[model samples]
Target: MSLPLPRDLARALAFFLAPLLLAPLALAQQSGAASPPPPAQGATKPLPVFEIPQSGVEFQTGDTWGQNGQTFRLYGIQSCIRGTTFTNPAGAKLDCGEASIAYLAALIRDTKPRCTAVAQTASPPLIYTVCAAHVGANTLDLGTVMVTQGFAFAATDANGKPVNLQYAVAEGEAQKAKRGLWIARDLPHPTAILNKALRDAERAQ
Candidate 1:
């Protein structure tokens, strides 16, 4: 006949078996196979890098269209303009044309200081350079970034020359931070607007 085990030996056996029961659970935590963290509020992620080939672009100026507002002299391919997120579907370009006055308004609002003067010309079409991609990084103020397909127009006469409308990217120099003119460089593309604005500002001094 076998003798009964001591109480201390039984307690030790139970302790050793405890981790065995929870091993899979512990492994999961250590391997970091858990759910992803949620996104923070108002985060503006950097957009992808997209460039409009200089060739596919076309230029036209003058209030031909019965539209009113700021113009974005485009240098890239003409993208179809959907309605603003407020009035129409956010990204639907069904009835919209190639120009976006709302975008220019927003750009002017945010970049008033640097853009002391924003006017249209009747000559060479202005070049609107779109970053290779959309703005990424949702960490910025949603009100500070304008998320839309990009476009630009002629800032001078039909001579195809660079007019004052030619802008540069002015990173961190904006005093108001309008969402339209604001290019979230936090994304991975070269922002010609910000770059041009910065250059213009530097030259002004």
Candidate 2:
């Protein structure tokens, strides 16, 4: 003879057994291991276009290429800010910023440049990236080229460390040749100019 279960005990037993009883049914309904949903029907993928959007900048498709694009800042290079001028070797005031922009545009003409993001900046929403700009069968590091040609300066990281040692070396070479901004004897570094600007803005506030 078996004893009958109490009303509360019977309810508790049902609750515990419900999931165990339904689990096999759920498994049987599934064909195999679960799989990701397929891509939407008739959805066309966006192709990457390699074009300079602005001075000293380029962008390409990111991991989510079709959904969102990524902008890349040429790593380890700083072009002069607009309206800034420096005396050249010929003692003429030159707009270094504009020259840097033009040089970068010419260097990347008609080539598909691909970049790898190495770091990110928050204030300006920029990604620091190293890019290989291809010209025919030759490839060039855009940042290194800019520094070596004296069109830009070797930039520093957020922590104040040099962004790239190679870029520093290239900058030294450019300086030795008295190329670009290095022609001036007492001209301040671009970074110093930028820092002074920031300090002035803060003092005004």
Candidate 3:
């Protein structure tokens, strides 16, 4: 009932995820850690950390964005790939990837989360981060919210090993609850599509 991931994406995931696999930050974690200790008395004050606003920010997928001329994705979240389709209740096909993008856009617009750089990939430059947003006086992980609500999924390698076990847990719960994208019984998982593409590519080798 499950499919594998492609090698390229798997490797990309590793760079963004290896650190998380070893140590996951506690819930409500923010970019405060990036802030240096206050300057000594009378010393020049350090500049406050800058924040990026979600307004007009472009989304590459449900979990990725184009930032600073590079790719920025949530550390352990994978959105559906673009161009995939699923049928709606009205018997019309809808773009699953676009649906994911829309959901993420809504979440960003409503939550205004703040993210800190957690990892990066060489060459192409993919910045990975963990973001938290305030909801009802409680700060929550953005990736957790997306996966738990079924708008995104836990990032995994080609063999299906998850980056963060907790994200896998969230995804499982969402699936069980049939939330968001899970509501479509015939939903086409992005990883499955990638796996098939990989297999086909390998066969042609």
Q: What is the C-alpha lDDT of each candidate?
A: 0.27, 0.52, 0.68
Predicted candidate 3 versus true structure: per-residue lDDT over 1-205, tens digit per residue: 3345455355433343443432333222333465333322343423222244666578877888765555567776778766777777777888887888899888878888887665444534455667787788999998999999998888765677776778999999999998988888788787666556656556766
Per-model TM-score, in order, reads 0.20, 0.57, 0.74
lDDT of 1 by residue, 1-205 (tens): 4344344233222222232333333334335857322212342332112322323222221111111222223221112222211223343322222234444343433432121111122221111222222233323211123222232221221232222222222223331252322232222122232233334445666
RMSD (Cα, Å) of candidate 1?
A: 28.7
Alpha-carbon runs more than 4 Å astray in model 3: 1-50
Give the least accurate 10-residue stretch of model 1, judged by summed lDDT: 113-122
Per-residue lDDT, model 1, residue 165, is: 27
* Most lDDT-accurate candidate: 3
Q: Give the worst 10-residue stretch by lDDT in candidate 2.
A: 59-68
Off by over 4 Å in 1: 1-92, 95-99, 109-149, 164-205
Query: RMSD in angstroms, candidate 2?
Result: 23.0
Superposed on all Cα atoms, the candidates' RMSDs to the truth, in angstroms, are 28.7, 23.0, 7.7
